[model samples]
Target chain A: MSFHLGGDKRASLAEAAARVGDGALVALGGGLCARLPMALVREMVRQGRRDLHLVGSAHSIDVDLLIAAGAVGVCEESYVGFEQDLGLAPAFRRAARDGSVEVRESCCATVLAQLRAAEAGVPFLPVRGIKGTDVEGLHPEYARMTCPFTGEELVVVPPLRPDVALLHAPLGDAHGNLHLDQPFVLDERFAHASVAVVATVDRIVPTAELVGAGVVVPGHLVAAVAEVPYGAHPSSCYPGYAYDRPHLAAYLAAATAGGTALDEYLARYVHVDEDTYAKDVDPERLAAWSGSTRAWQELFR
Target chain B: MSWALDAGHAAQRSWTLDEAFVVALARTIRDTEAVFHGFASPCAQVAMHVAKRTHAPDCLLIEGATYAVDPVPVFVPPTGNDLALHRDAVYRMRFEEFFDAACRGAVDRMFLSGGQIDGYGSTNVTAIGGMPHPKIKLGGGGGGGNISASIGALTVWTSRHRAGRTLVADLDFLTDLGHRTREGSRAELGYTGGGPQWLVTELGAFDFDGDGHARLRALWPDVDVDDVAAATGFELRVALDGADGLLDPPSPAELAAVRAVDPLGVRRSEFAEVELARTPGLSGVAR
Candidate 1:
């Protein structure tokens, strides 16, 4: 596939989210509740695009916000929940409970298998194990095949090529080369499997200065790179900041209260611009959390 | 590299339910084993790191961060699973590679938890009460649901277990299907190995006995037999000879070790932890 930036790759978060267009199957990076593209996610909600499909193996805040905003129409994920630490996600829980959302619950393997198939440009990926589990019957539209070599039944997942891949990285260049200190965690696969990828980073550095550290998402696959500092706030960006626990706690508190409380939170946080949204949080605490984390994360150097 | 600090303050505090749970979970980890922590697993992450630093120094610890640093740091994320938790790990592994290891049975043990757990070791991390659409929809089978069917053993860390919420007569959904894929079908699906080798809860610890039913192996010090039995909806199998086998409380050394990695009290956050502990540092790396 030929890679094109449509022009200059450096764009705003709004511009990157706008490039995704409407009704696109979006793939979010990060596992559980880390490294999510919260800036872009909030932008999608701010723009009010409905009838969208989400594809990712593990998700937390990114999926929850999308579900709460009533923007996601379908989701193909391993599972969507705040880890044991944060309890259950309220907006997503309520939406799924009411049947307004269509969720395809999978073991993490199936989701990875689908992404691998898409990255390989294949129709299906044959995976071992999970043939006898509920993964068999979850998606009737999907099928299971017999492995030709061993004649053993294998779970075959359909290719899940996303229209756009949105993720947050620790560092990136103006040309869209991303440097993430952490493991790929399915972000590289998403970049390969998606038609276009939008990355939000802590900073856009000079390409010449991005030495020693390897580029995780190559510039060619990236459609745009937005230098949005604290882009993954409320979520952690390795080598940069940690998740805002107090902020997440407040959001959870509001979400659990249900109804108007969630709306009030979105109005103050998600609906506002990056600057105003960030102001809602104490700048000192955010700096300290990220500051304490830098030494441990930067040991890669 | 950041220098190690004194872990003195954290040691003096009493071990809470979450801390005891961490020690119990850590004991299950054997040396020279490969372990993985799945989604939303804070308690499990702490246990793996604790064991890696102490008893099982050679154990292969894997998580999303793909961290591979020598002499791991006490990198704790305030929220859920983060790469920082895997700080000082000496290798970078992708999810696909981990999946390959799982399918090949290269993994020895893993940590798992769900919205619901039954007496037979089947867990429901998916929806509750109904299907397609349900009364409650929690996060569905992360890696655990598949790990139950693929991995060799599971160490479930459940912080809270109420009658209707967790311990139940029947699971609302079977996200993780171990040897007991169905209630009566034990490893009939060709998947072998005992399921839920160590099932640790807030009240006690359990293991699947010979007949594939949950056997109560140990209980927390504070709780009595009635307290545990009443909290459970199903008939629990207690260890014979009247020895409740109370879990060994976290030694000062264990607390110091826990404080080293978790100086911020992330573990304590499960039940309202404080940032700065004033107590003596029973830990090795004093605060």
Candidate 2:
């Protein structure tokens, strides 16, 4: 691989954040409480980046936190609610309620279909489910096509190519060979779907350590790899840590209470780097992080 | 004794609305059949697990978020994607792979809930008000559109079956394409699966009639037929004459199994917190 395309892609979280420009469309990896780049997002908030576009990143705290920090302009969402217990995400709710964030609603399936189209280097892809749905009528960007042979109606979704992908992996080499601990079916597709992929990993191991069968995001696809251990805190990272329930609960509370409470949350936790934040927070709670639900595994066994 | 079978003979009258609804949904699970549950489906997860433990012991499970069927954990993580479900996963596949399987005719059943479902069974999870931008934006379909088109039997469940917000006369936007404008729409799309087979709500159970409209098939106890009709925004097609076709409450065996799977009671969270407080020493008999 040429040095320009695939060389030492190692950098600090701030450097990785710098690579993303204003109004760049970004793909978020491992959404819904797993492997979100929390530190990179926090660093982006610190850097005061604006007008960033988020795609396929809805329905999780990852996007909620960024939107709360006022870093997003446009968002293409499949789903955008918090868990049933957590109610709606506060920032996202306020943003959507006020129409500040230019919101485009796509089904969860459509996002994957769009990403798959991008991965395959196709201009547009036809989906069987889009017809006769509100998702069809709302977006003029989506058009209906009659199958030439069958004369069947189908929705044609245009290709979605993100400028960058914000991803978190369990381990990676200094050369940027990222290995995700879970199945993570969408990571590779998102990486190929984007012009650049930046990842925050828990550990940077030798190239040899990333061997064997697993979900591997190869060095060539990754533009930068920053070591932000526990980067996925408040969200689970396999074999590294589980989701911080208390932290998540705190965030939910703050988000629910809104106003100065949210600002305080940003100041207390997000404003600080991982180290000082970790020091301020309880280590015992952080220790709750683990690879899998061992309790569930043992129960089934 | 394990809650799995320690359950005693509790009369059907003792069942909560949610419990009765779950049992009603579970009865549809045929033995030795593959059923797929999608995102934000905690109630259906509990129902599927109960179905496996009771009547449909051999019924297979394929969860959308975790992609694990018959998850060992009785409790679904509040996060729609429960990692516990990933333990000993049978066949983990993405939504795209599953939808592709449906396109090729693989998935037999799917359970989905939405913000709004119309009389025709077309689900609208895309927008609450008129399109372009909705008054209330909802979580969009993960793959419900393809699943409803492909899955032979799509069981649509909702906790609160209110009018306007839920059981609408017509959808503002269509999230899952159930039966197009007319009956032949699926055929036009080359979809093989029967669209939106069953609809489960708080008050009653429903299915599409020969005319491709939501026909109330059964009602839970204490639910008035007229009340259900009034709750539905559209004119509903009442299939059953009376309590004649109404399903009995879940058996003590099924209830026990449901309890074992949902020890935390996440499924009944739609009710206020006061619902959790018992009258006096019922330990945990109430939903």
Candidate 3:
């Protein structure tokens, strides 16, 4: 069967984390500043699930928070600034000092390669271009083999078939067809590579209306769907709505501050419910702040 | 010449006679041997073109962006430094491994330019106000001016209106320091490579003096030193015997090669029409 009706769309992020299994390759949607499911990600960390392998592009604030909380076991790429979203020098420095995170090269490509391998039904794909750099030694799971003809070392990237994939979309129908104009990086690929795909949409429309609207993700790949209004909020859908810059700014300040500063910051901002946090944060406050607000602000603003 | 012919065929309709100038400059620099190009630089394109065509067919083209030698043309969609292409190369590397390469003397020649370069070959690509927080935030200088000053040799290029942008006084920010301020400082800092060698501009080229300061070396034919002096915002001291050489108008082949790599003419786009009109002679050279 292509459909399952085990969960409610209005369920909390913590409840969603319960659905994810151990060692499952999870692809989180959203860009460096887009509407990411940070609430679910935080719950995953609080639950202390080490078996899950996380991957994404740029640095998602949610990802950094999880890593900071000691919930993440391995990260393939570096975490950018909490404000500027440029270099993750500070985060990497802290991670190095703590010796908790394993910094790998090409987080996006490595994850993409795994998805590609799985989609192709191949055990491994021979990838060129990553031979000599630091990425090779970081992920021992992928071996480096030499080409007999050219004598060049090629990375043998193993297939990534995620047990479950979690994604957020702008809208969907009860039948589970997703629709989104933005957040189009590797969402489709992640869906195809996973055994089950769980998508959260902003609102649910009639299947006929969605089909006629030409915004669809073909019900075949999607296993379940949930309608969560204003879901993308602070993470933004781009062109649909601007990011909640003030909330992002506060998160960045707390994130980079470290020690009790980070803890207090997360408690006041991140840990709270979406409604309460939204009401508390005045989006217009970002307009008043001059200069580069923080790394995260650069992602959207 | 044979490589040029091959490149011509590869570029097809995009190849024009103007490319020869870039090709020639590349050849000139390649002949010098052991030249380095900075990240996301047009000079890198010229250097690579010259290396592939002439002296160093087998020369190691080191890149800060990516390590891979793309088989496709240099100007292709992804270009050379797309992280997707090079991610696997440095996979799993600790920060120390990358720093080791920079700390060591493995890097040779480098290319850099300052927002305001003074009589001394010093450049400032940093913020003008202050550190920790500046009133205006200029992007961080990649490796400070250390790469230019410490590398075996350095090449500096500026396309800005000389008089307005190029200056007389020291810069507000020290983007890249040409050389160590004090004697014996090089050894103290563990730097052993050579310092700034050539400063190329639309007007012509300049080089450092014995004390490692800028001295006008050569001017293009049909251009007078007075015009150059007028164009410069700073007081430029020309060498007593400074001579004028036909700044070989870029050969058709050289211009074609440069245009092929940069179709939009990112270099020329930086200049204003008023500036271009003021320097009619330089305009012809740019075209």
Candidate 4:
């Protein structure tokens, strides 16, 4: 692991995206459709980062968009579909099938175990299950040993140290102290385990305000931070805004249509400036979602 | 896919096929147990809600995405991660803490499904064909591999089991621990939890026998033994008592509980288009 003790760790979205080099192993910080760091992801796409290896527990558009942009070559995630909402991720499915991407399938428990091992500075950690299933055979890094105390056989996974972790949050300080929201899927673990963390936040507050809000990630653990409002546009940064269902539907339509349609979508959204993308997504309308319970419910309708 | 508008609680005559199937799913839950449902499982989510509102009120319900414990959401949202699902949650579980509890055999039951579920109870959510490149890359099993080894029981369901490629004779890849697998039996593998207890499908329900194979236990209305046998890829095994295996239709109370818990009819999305057309009030609902 690495530490950033600098007094100010803030950077532009492009600079934060540059912190993740080409062919680097990236730890995606959120799960499903919430706080997925999409602004930074779009910037990375525009910069043409290539051969990224993505590691996560569960994800959707963030990972799919990278693959669709031809930036990802290896996927180590346990799950990559859109859950019950939109069904499977079309680009990921196609890439995995056509042999464009390597699928090192993992489970949530093993991924957590690997990250915990890295966090503890251990070489490996034993996981409770995964034996007798084909998943065990797929991971050559996994080994079997007898428990010294109980003489029971167990599977142990090696520690995974990603090159950089991408995270999005509701609040963070210029120094990199972050107040992550709940359902903190694997963001805390990813922050602690990765070598460096590059993040985007809806707003960057003072260190005092951040500490008052309860800091989940301390300043020293983060490499860089970019204050980009509505950073997780298509995805939800809860208490800030709900996921843009219509935008996601349009994206799915374009991606499902084929390469040309997807490229046109990228040209219209990804290659644009942050302010333009925000305006196109209608920030005022998205901000109004949290005005009331009824408004929030109507967002999904 | 737009869900049919709720229409603000229109009158209905009979329960739809999805409601009947959800009641069958709820029957598998014990009154006192810790049950977990994963994301993308609308039927299981509705079943858990129905069971809690009706029979299994004390069951420790866990939301898949939010990880909230004992949440009393007004209705199940289309997406699992919304704060709507976390409304009135007694406690929110962290990702690591819940898995740690499952490793200690704390989770009593979990809901699981697959692209292919074999007679031995093994499931394949990993892929459809060979490894290096699969014919179809299914959504990989999120935590089923470890949870299946530690949880007390598993309730397997598949809506596409009606002559679809669901109940296969062999799985291309075994993604979860079952009664027995390519490596060995669960006892040999030292699995702490009992494997799949029931396999509920659109056609019928199955219970594992002493030999650890799926045996027919109940049939849905209008589904005969021949129909199930024709759809099944493996040789069918029936319970010792033949005619008694027919599943009883959902009672009025059970139907009312399902409707109350799922006012938006979110569970109807689990069915195919042909099946959705069979729904009572929301007939011809397009997905």
Candidate number achieving the greatest DockQ relative to the actual structure: 4
- List iRMS for all predictions: 4.3, 4.1, 13.7, 1.3
The lDDT, on a scale of 0 to 1, for candidate 4 is 0.85
The candidate that wins on lDDT is 4
After superposing candidate 4 on the true structure, give the runs of residues whose Cα lies further than 4 Å from its correct spot: A287-294, B1-13, B240-247, B279-287
Number of the candidate with higher lDDT, 1 or 3: 1
lDDT score, residue A190, model 3?
69
Off by over 4 Å in 2: A1-4, A212-215, A283-301, B1-15, B162-165, B181-190, B241-246, B272-287
For model 1, the superposed segments whose C-alpha errors exceed 4 Å read A5-7, A279-285, A290-301, B1-17, B63-71, B83-89, B162-165, B183-186, B192-194, B221-224, B241-246, B249-252, B268-287
lDDT of 1 by residue, A83-128 (tens): 6567778877887788787877766677777887888888898655
What lDDT is reached at residue B6 by model 3?
34
Q: Considering TM-score, which of the candidate structures 2 and 3 is the better prediction for this target?
A: 2
lDDT by residue for model 3 over B187-245, one digit each (tens)?
Answer: 33334556567666656567777766666776644356776787776457677343233
The per-model DockQ list reads 0.39, 0.40, 0.04, 0.63
The positional error of residue A260 in candidate 1, measured at the CA in angstroms, is 3.6
lDDT of 2 by residue, B1-287 (tens): 11122235435335555665566778777886788876666788778887878888887777656665555763566666646556566556654566577655677778877778877778877567755556776656766765677677788777768543689887777778676553346666577778777888876788877767888877654466887877889787887743333256556787777777776666776543433232211223344
Q: Of the candidates numbered 2 and 4, which has the greater lDDT value?
A: 4
The TM-score of chain B in candidate 1 is 0.82
On TM-score, the stronger of 1 and 2 is: 2
